[model samples]
Target: MNARLQPFVLTIAAALLLLGALTYSARAADPEPAEAPRPALTVTVVQPQRMAIPMRIAANGNIAPWQEASVGTEANGLRLAEVRVNVGDSVKRGQVLATFAPETVLAEQAQIKASVAEAEAALAEAAANAQRARDLQTTGALSAQQINQYLTAERTAQARLEAQRAMARAQQLRLGQTRVVAPDNGIISARSATVGAVLPAGQELFRLIRQGRLEWRAEVPATDLGRVKPGQAVEVIGASGSRLAGKVRMVGPTVDVQTRNGLVYVDLASSDEARAGMFARGEIEIGSSQATTLPQSAVNLRDGFHYALRVGPDNKVSQLKLKVGRRLGDRIEVLDGLPADARVVASGGGFLGDGDLVRVVQAANAASAPTPAPAQAAAPAGR
Candidate 1:
């Protein structure tokens, strides 16, 4: 009875061992290959474009009059009368500006007139005497010596009368100098002479600015002087960012030793808001050309080298090395490497590596409006 039970137990043990072996074999089937690592970023990209761009250099400066002058009296006398002009008044050339005391000049003029009259009478007398002396000498009615003496006396009298006439003419000229007249059309900037004030010769009585024309003198650093030139168009922005157009009239030939800068003069006319002596900021169009330009956001600098990711026809990304030109505003010029129609990653470009597989979506195809800069990990430095 014991031997038969032993056989049954052995069969059960074998069945259990076979079931365990089958379960282990099913679990040993090959596992699936590992998936590729995904890119850690999403980005927005734009195509490079060719457009007209104005290259400008910026500076700050002050406004001043182009032609400023101080007009003073030439004659020495008390101010007897002032004309209708005052400070800030516009005056025309040759307009009477002021008058010295007329009484003194009038008295001198009268004396000159009387002297002229006396001299004319003496000339008449001398002429008559000379004629008589000539007749006497020819007819022998008088001694030759006597006639000669009379002629000499008449010549002396004529000389005296001529001297008197010259003195009278000088007096008249001096009287004309008493009235001050404007030398040019200008606006009066100052007035120091009153109606009753006495001014000496060469005393400044007025200051004027001619024709209301003004200039902006911008102090440009010596390093930036190359960007300024005569006849270049410039724009001036005020403290409030108001803009006005002007042309450069002059560029100083020499740099100032103290400030290490040069002056650039921009001529300006009166505008509804522009005023002289106001602080202004100027931007000059130093140079310009048509070029392919892209926003700075589209460029990525790695390892001190510039690069851009170009999108292919199939919306795949490839690395593009670029040569860059001068920076203009928010955009940078693509001097090399990028074709005119190549699309570049505008934002989040730093996240991409060379030859990386990307599932790109059109920047405009996002269901949600393109969000402003979202937080992303820092980009790796390129080699």
Candidate 2:
């Protein structure tokens, strides 16, 4: 190659290299710069307010029949003839629940009646004889020993009549017991007697729950024993989600040694919706308190510590270390690390991080969330 042509080729090569470098630089400058890290979320602050909050204990339990009865018979040699009551039937005192065959009873009763008649006849004959003996003694026709003998015979006959009367009464009682009767007003829960089935004396035939009254038996922790007392109001939740109100009727005298809990009996309010043995949860209002509270959603639990995001006056977000106190309904008390007038992010706090920029919005009323209605709310009647 010629020398001049070589220099010209090198210059051309250099120009091409410089152009390629410039094109790469322009391409890099065309793209947008990476966005800057956003600040923490801003949230409308809430001023912690003083309010009456209920102190309560939640415990699991079961519904129980207030009074349970196992029905039985006291008359032997009787066979079931008819059942007049069935399960779920309401009964009153003296109401006949069942009838038994009265054949043997009637036979015995008839025989006693015959014996009673015979004794009466014999008594009459002896009395007549005693009168005749006395008249003969007055006339000196009968000796004193003979008259005494006749008087003794008359007294024996009268005594025998009296004994027969007592036997008749016993037979009547046995006959009456052949029919099973309700001892008190109640609802029948079970029936075992069947027609033609022979049952011996003291045989259980039915079960009843007296007066349809029910109670919830809650097992509260021994440590919470101080929070429970008789006559305190409570709320009971059934397995079916039925809510019933009641008053504590009794506190057990002893605690269960194994569970370390005590039994609390709560008499159900006037609703008949509750049934025996249903799983139940009860809340007993132990006391009342006044403190700063926040919605449950506002709090976050991380590494066993409770925290909330608070918006500072500068609209910057900061994580607040919080100590929570007793929970009243859907809100928990903020024990510390929060000022009464600070705005804490409630709904969106869980999804935010420190220093993330967030547009702040006012939180709705905390009372709108799930919380116990105050006692003065005037509970609806009939449960």
Candidate 3:
């Protein structure tokens, strides 16, 4: 071997060793495989439950008197002398409400009585004359024409006496009419009669709420009128946020042509807050039926619609649009768009989006989880 050939062989061996070292270093610096992402959120879930949902019909209306009694004067051209009751006064049946001046009526009655007495005296005289006429006719001592005239006079006097008695009775009735009395037990709602004011016949003096009772005139849609029946329970929500209990009295026979609405008269239980002419809203419970219900926390409102977060077996959530019905406390009826067995996110759903991965925690587990201690300030360094 020549010396130049030996140097070349050693150089080739060194280059090969360096190439192997570089290859090992590159393999060692390669990064490890990345891990799959964990669940981004933890949430509690719930399932639909079957419950009895009450069927109710909603209505709006005004409060009014059950029956308004229009009290008016029957005596004509009588001056009211005294008024015993005013608006808002409670009255009993036959209670005196007002009194007219009785002087004129009494005087007229006295005059009729005197006339009646005079007629009675005249009738007695005529009866005596007729008896005499009859006696003389049998004896043939009086002519038939003269006897008939006496008899006719007697009959005329008798008729006049009866007429005077009838007039006297009429005058007595007029005297009684001077006093205005309550026709029925009620509360006075309005009054137009005043002392010293002369009123004519049939003039209204007071308006009374019969038996102090109030009613709610609910206007229900004509299509739903058939559902209302007598004696059904009603819950009325008043303008002041008070709830009143009532019962359905009757359904109107006809519906309004323009609004296609029928009226339902509901008798409200007596209450101080209930007043006539107040606008109110209410619901009538017709019946009940089974329904699939879910907690309100499980439902979401977005984009003018309701939604629920449905959890799949893969721990992925899908947003579901919901058709919901009547809502009770903390629970809502699921009318459509959801299966009875579906599991939905109970709460914290507002922070989630569709198709997001989630970790489910049961109610018991969530309740039992250890509460994190509030962070404490670090102690001053070796104070």
Candidate 4:
């Protein structure tokens, strides 16, 4: 029984020895476990460009009428019968904006006409008597004193008729004044007249923006006033995001003592979106200057500051804080923090961290770069 048990133990030992040998061989053939080296990001790099950037002076102010004309009732103490125009109405020169009670003026004019007619009739009779007296004097049938009295009467009647006509003319003028017309082509900005409301002479019925023109009066720093000049091109941006093209009409002759600010008057072209009393911001194009600029896409904003991802010789990215300036179109001025000869990631810097390894390529090649394939299991050691 002991010999049989020994044989079975020997067979089991042999099988275990063969199994251990195979395991050792498989372990020897396996590859080492380690991560493959790959770049953190494939990116396009760009160099700063020296370009001519337009120099502009920024300011803020209100949009207002270029010139305002007051439209008022010329005749006094007349009731506003009809208001033909309202606020925001576009009007032409001599266009009727309001009408007063013309009945009263017309009645006065009629009375004046009657007086003139009566005077004219009296003058005709007096003239005929004066002519007869003169003829009789020459014929020795009339006294000189009587003839002289007739001549004086004719002259007085003539003067009275002229006075009556002048009064009639004045009454007619009043009648015309009952209707208020626009003094110039404009848009009505304010309306004070109402139907049946009696207004006095020179009472404003409407306020018109002369020629429908508008302007931006910007307050600029007094220290920068010398940079502004008349006729310089300006671009005004309103609160509603409306852009208006304008030219500098004039700069204020004096600056405020307390605020140290001056006014720049910019005459803007008419636009439907622009209105009086709207606050706005604008830039005056003073001139152009050479500046180092970069594309906006290449810049990153983080923690309330701007940054650029600059690439090093070793292909590692160094996050650089940037001091940026004016922006025009797709380019932004780099005032500092970036060397002129350094290359930076064109875009996608937001996804990276400092000292990140990246693969740099040309823009044209980057667009056509193929996506990396997924890693696969290593081939079996023997295979």
Candidate 5:
């Protein structure tokens, strides 16, 4: 009985072992399962646009008086008796600014007046003598030569009297010259005259800014000088961040050879913030023109160049180089290098490279994504 059962068990055990081996060999022969493909990046896109933009030229310059009026003394070798105005004082035309010592002029005028009085007496006597000579000539009561001599003496006295009167008038003019008056309405920028200080004729006493007006002398590049025209509006920015409005008055006739720049004179509207000798930056509006533009977010800067991620029909992104111009607000002008109808990534372009697979997402859907709630705190165990 043991021999027969042992043979049957041995056969069953051998068949079980063979089945296990075959199962193991089949599992080892099968290939591994493939990995899943990565999901495409989702992004928002926008189209190029066209709009009008202002053309302007930026320049820097100093503010100065529109015209400087130099006031000088007319009375030579006279001591300045009084100065009525100082630096930064406003004066009107015909206003007295200074006065020279009038003592010497007054004394000379008195001497001339005495001489004039003496001449009047001499002319009266000459008139009587001339009448007598005329009477004698008709009667021939005296020789013709004697009568002629009397007439000639009378004429000489008359001439001397006339000369004395002219001297008196000149002396009067000298007295009037002692007072210095403002030539124009203006603000005094400098003063050199002082009380009791002797000054010669034609010596400057004060420098006035005519009409208190100022101008901005913008130094523009010679190449851009032609773009600046008279009557164009300009905005000047001061160092204190104040803005002053001005108009282009004129452009210099010649360009400076050393700096390659030209002067564009701009008349500044009167403002308290604007003053002479101030350095300011200005922008002059040349005109306006149409330009192709895009949102600033759509452009990306890479490797020191500007690029935009252009999407293809298959929703794939390609980096496109662009030439950019003036930028205003959130929009930038595309001067060239982009098609009008091309779609570009609205934002997050910096994260993308050329030829990247992307998923086009509606802007409304992306903006509507629910914000994640803050994590809740753990509760006490005993609660």
Candidate 6:
């Protein structure tokens, strides 16, 4: 090989080596890429507000008639001839609800009437004889013993007449009682009288709700008895989900011995949906009060305790256990364990844990957002 060619080959090799060194330097200057930080959840914030919450005593009760009447048979040993009104029939006062076989009663009454008539005839004759005897005694035409005997006979006859008249009146009363009538305006709730059943005196034939009115008998705890009073407003919800507005009519005088509960009687407004013997729940409006409350969705239920997720300024979430009270609509009363000015997650708190970082979005209700507190000046060092 020629020495000149060797020198040219070395120069080309040096240029290639320079290019490789420049490429290595550029690769070393570039920085490594970092991983992207993700948020656990994107949420909104809320602040508690002061609102009016109803103070109520919740109670379980039964729906019953305001007053009940038991219509019974007053005629003894009489067969029910006809039933004019059945269960669910409305009746007025003195309305005939049923009729018994009045034939026997009528016969007795007629016999008593005949006896009364005979007694009246006998009394008239005795009065005439007494008057003659008195006149004769005054004139000395009759002996004293004869006069005394005539007076005794007249007196006995008059007394017998009075007794017969009294028996006749009683029979008439029995005859009228054969027709079972309503004592008051009401709705028949029950009827046990059959068409041909022979009923005795005082046997109940029908049960009636007086005046077609109903009541709610609320069983309240003994502790809350003092809070109940007459004329308080009550909202009762029946088992069929029907609501009835009622006013407290009375409070029971005594509490039950076994349950330590008292009964509160509430007279309900006129409603067709309410009936006797229905189970119901009631909320007595004891009063109202100002309370700090939050939306129910913002609170989470865990292990029978309520919790809320509080958002920090650094976009971190802190779980706060809350003591809650009555829930109205979609809001709930916060009794304790939460600050009135706390900025908490609006919803979805169940998915978060303590110390979880979250990305807070703009609040929907800006007016409810808590204002930022004023910044304080730094204190002088070592003052």
Best by the lDDT measure? 3
Q: What is the TM-score of each candidate against the true structure?
A: 0.66, 0.78, 0.77, 0.80, 0.73, 0.74
- Backbone clashes for every candidate come to 1, 9, 0, 0, 0, 0
Candidates in order have lDDT scores of 0.76, 0.82, 0.87, 0.86, 0.84, 0.85
What 10-residue stretch in candidate 1 is worst by lDDT?
374-383
Task: Specify the poorest-scoring 10-residue window by lDDT in model 2.
Answer: 374-383
**Runs off by more than 4 Å, candidate 6:** 1-45, 301-321, 348-383
- Where does candidate 3 stray beyond 4 Å? 1-45, 310-319, 351-383
Error of 2 at 22 (Å): 29
- As for lDDT, the candidate ahead, 2 or 4, is 4
What lDDT, from 0 to 1, does candidate 1 have?
A: 0.76
lDDT of 5 by residue, 1-383 (tens): 69869999999999999999999999999868999555367888888776666677889999999999999988889999988999999999999998888999999899989998988898888778878988888888888888887888788888988899999998888888898999999999999888999888899999999999999999999999988899998888887888888899999999999999999999998988988999998788887678787777888877767899999998788888998887655667787889988988889888888887888876873332232211111111112
Error of 4 at 78 (Å): 2.7
lDDT tens readout by residue for model 3, 92-135? 99999999999999998899889989988988998898899999
lDDT of 2 by residue, 11-95 (tens): 9999999999999999998997889765555455455556677767788898988889889999886889999988989999889
Candidate 6 overall lDDT versus native: 0.85
Task: Sort the candidates on lDDT, descending order.
Answer: 3, 4, 6, 5, 2, 1
Q: 138, model 6: CA deviation in Å?
A: 4.1
Q: List residue ranges in candidate 2 displaced over 4 A.
A: 1-44, 270-273, 301-304, 356-372, 375-383
Q: By TM-score, who's the top model here?
A: 4
Clashing pairs in 4: none
Better of 2 and 3 by TM-score: 2
Weakest 10 consecutive residues, lDDT, candidate 4?
374-383
RMSD of each: 9.0, 8.5, 11.6, 10.7, 11.7, 9.1
**Pairs that collide, model 6:** none
